[model samples]
Target: MGAVRETLDAVRLVDHHCHGTVAADLGRDAFESLLTEGEAWPGISPFDSPAGVAVRRHCAPLLDLPRHTPAEEYLARRSELGRREVQRRFLRAAGTDVFCVDTGYAPDPLTTPREIAEAAGGTSYEVVRLEGVAESVQTAGVEPDAYADTFRTAALEAVRRPGVVAVKSVAAYRTGFDLDPARPSEVEVTEAARRWFARGGRLDDPVLVRHLLWTAVDLGLPLQLHTGFGDSDIRLHRADPARLTDWLHLTAGTIPVLLLHCWPYQRQAAYLAAVFERVYLDVGLTLHHVGPARAGGVLAEALEITPFRKLLYSSDAYGVAEFFHLGALAFRQGLAELLQGRVDADELSLPDALRIARWTGRDNALRVYRLEADGPEDD
Candidate 1:
């Protein structure tokens, strides 16, 4: 008990993946207001029907509306939204000191890179991480198969960036389910990705995902994959994390692949994490769907069997600052207490408690991202 308490106390964690920068740009007040009004941010799909719209209005304030204006208005708000003041305020709720900003769609060249670096340095945390995916397929109308070379080139370049710390692919079903891990062979998937690129689809295809995995392994880099259940249209059957066995087998001992929030399928995800040697996971969307109570239970169950060291903290924070702030705070408190069990209250040690927190909080990301090592420091 003392050691667990001490472990949780010494924890120094980082949110491996977050869209805090986008929330910062929204200005706290604006974000709060919009959230109250029921607008959806980019991470979760937008509402389409009148009923959905009504639901968002009721649920908006509960969301961390990290932004106020439309995508077109981002540039003018950069200066104020990019500052450390908002970041510090946000971190006060969650005990993290660093976060990685995913700048996949910054319109302004200067703003995009600058935001990444600056956000890291902001009060809530430091280190702005950059990432790049094969935009050639979607933007160029090329076949998914044709984009392999282009993806490779882009990934190589992204890896070279000074602040980039990881590589990722947005190929899986973002709706409510996970992709069938048993689906096509890696080669088949890669070819499909190439064709998707050729067709001018804006999303990464299977080919790019295969190439990204191989490249990450070769470079000793960590890769984040959009797994589990997300979006509304995703097939629940395909969303099971169990199907990732083959994929995990392929990357075993080579490079780490993080499964992001399989939610309803978290048990499945946890089971896979327990079996895989190099797999890691995060509960990104659970903040919204599972609530703090259930989230605590789910996470505790996962940590009890799988190595606690393999878990990482993340909200997949996007659209609003409050969402990131509160979600993170809830995770910290929930996870901390969950790990404590029925220990003597007077025996609690902040350092031990923090250390436990770090295992799932920041240490996992550091190890997976290989951030402490001296190298290119990018993907």
Candidate 2:
């Protein structure tokens, strides 16, 4: 236990994928709403969920309260501290040195990348969401035949922007992983865009989604694909990362493909990471929701067959600073316990356990994302 504590406590995490904290103080209802990914039940509160309970136990202390503070009292205390101080407490407590932020989801009312860096006292970089860029082009009214060229230009420009470290896709939410391995033809993309434009709705066209993905691939930046358990938008069965085998084979050495939030299919994700040199996985959003007690089990399963270097840390935290703290807390506790157990049992040496801890917690992300060793220092 002493050795485990030493290794994990010394780790300064790199949150490879996450989102910004809410810019304002949240009321009880608002705070509870961020606790679960599921839609709210009319009669029940979100605070009754696993994530909410975990927050009361783990996060209450960071807010200067005793562990297991009552939710009502917790909320009252949070309100009293106000948003900025609360953000400061939780983000600093997480002890992350760098944040690679996905700035696409629910963009409004959240801290910008610069703001997140300022609040968290860490370096920050941007992950350009392919779908958001596509939607912006569509909303800007690109001509049908010009859509492909227009999108290409937009994607290239996005990746070239300062502080942009990677590109991401919510393809699991838009279309499942069962996409054709080949890039869509120019004609196919134009027609898909035309029809989507004619329908005048969100960009759910599979062809356009495919085009967007391949475009990101062509740019040669690490590409993040959301997989497994997500919001109501995800079809659990269809979100399996295994379905991506065909596409993974197609894009084999082009760029690193990161599978995010893999829960129910973590073993499958592990298999992919083992077989493909360019594939990697993270159990981020899943960890904080499961809380510290169960986080070790999930982390154990994810690491069971995964190459140590192919695993990375992430909070997947959005709209709330507690998630940032909770995700990091769960990861450190869970991983330390598992690795130390192996050392105690003589399955791994103390030195090897400490080295593996640093690889997963920070070094792996830096290598995959091409980030500097120290990242952009906080100004």
Candidate 1 lDDT (Cα, whole model)? Answer: 0.54
Residue 86 miss distance in model 1 (angstroms): 4.4
Taking all chains together, each candidate's TM-score versus the true structure is 0.68, 0.97
lDDT digits (tens) for residues 81-119 of candidate 1:
453544444444454455655656443222232343344
**Best prediction by TM-score:** 2
Please write out the lDDT profile of model 2 over residues 1-379, one tens digit for every residue: 5687677878889999999877788987788878999888888987787898889999999888999899999999999999899988998899888899998887447888777787777789999999999889999988999999998899999888888999999999988877887899999998999899999877788898889888988999999999999989888888999999988888899999999999989999999999998999999999999998999999999999999999999999998999999999999999999999999999999999999999999999998998974555321
In order, candidate lDDTs are: 0.54, 0.90
Cand. 2 Cα-lDDT:
0.90
Cα displacement (Å) at residue 186, model 2: 0.9
Top lDDT hit: 2
